[model samples]
Target: MGEGRLFESIGRALGLPPEAVARFGVDGPAEAAVLVETALRASGFRTDVTLYIDASRARALTSVEVATRVAPLLGEEVLVSPPADDPAVATSWFLITPGGERFRAREASPGNDSDCVEIDRASLRPG
Candidate 1:
């Protein structure tokens, strides 16, 4: 799952105010996923993601997204997930790529889904 602390981390890295993020009506953890995606993509990197849906928590016809974390830690890819047991959980992601290909990846997880945002992980971190 996308940890709120991660969002806070992205906020600082992306140079966005947490209040502006808070205004998005992202109350629980689900919305936090979207917020994390938006902030990361807006930071100007090609991002990609895969979303998993539990179907039980979705209120409307929601799409999939990436459950975000530090992803892959040392690779170009990262995996994101939240506990399936969490009620306000997010299981999908809006993947962003340098080529503008925003779609889901053909993968499934009963947990935090996967990365919906792609950063130059190789450039951003060490192996």
Candidate 2:
């Protein structure tokens, strides 16, 4: 999907406003060109999104930094998962919904690794 459409879909799924969704692509055009794999779950849509940040900047980007930037955007009601011992790991944070559903978010991979945030639909229900 096109970047704009992709962000729109994500916003709809997560119940984020347009301005909030725009943060994902704040870096640049290429920043929003994330690899997204979506599935239809019994609750709703679940999406795994891998963001591609600029390699030059990614070298200094830590998982904590990525999480810090993302968590607040998900809103105050969402709970964040604990951090790993190593701050550089791709798996940084898991966003827990009010319904107790979990979704993961991480920093961009240094190599060709396909890591991303797994966003469960805002309407997700506890199973």
Candidate 3:
């Protein structure tokens, strides 16, 4: 490959597209995350994602199962209810914070920014 062509290929591999990325807030971050996940997959970059969750068993059949079921199809590592002290994971999970009308719904059951759980995968407990 020509040196110039090699550089262009590298840029593409590294995700330097001309189109600016879109950002969403905490609300409906799922949809945005899905987009980012798609881009990452297209670019061949493996990623691990986390989400904010609670200890309530009641929520198990709800988002918990829903997100887990969604991950394999999307090909992502997902976690829920991460540590509040870790800023890296804390920031990682908020892939999209939907705004306007979407943000309105997010406010109702706000996902904790501090928690570091995976958004679309289930946690496997060790015996």
The predictions' CA RMSDs to the true structure, in order, are 13.5, 11.0, 17.0
lDDT tens per residue, model 3, 3-71: 233223222323333122122235533422111211122211223323232233112343334334433
Q: Write the per-residue lDDT of candidate 1 for residues 62-89, one digit (tens) a residue.
A: 2212222223222223433333554424
State the local distance difference test value for candidate 2: 0.41
Residues 14-116 of candidate 2 have per-residue lDDT tens digits of 4444333443433534333232333322321233344443344333444334444443444322324445664633444455543434555443333442343
Judging by lDDT against the true structure, name the best candidate. Answer: 2
Q: How much is the lDDT of residue 14 in candidate 3?
A: 30
Question: What are the lDDT scores of the predictions, listed in order?
Answer: 0.34, 0.41, 0.28
Q: Which one wins by lDDT: 2 or 3? A: 2
- Candidates 1 and 2: which is better by TM-score? 2
Looking at model 3, report the run of 10 residues with the lowest lDDT sum.
98-107
Q: Which ten residues in a row have the lowest lDDT in candidate 2?
A: 37-46
Per-candidate TM vs. native? 0.23, 0.30, 0.22
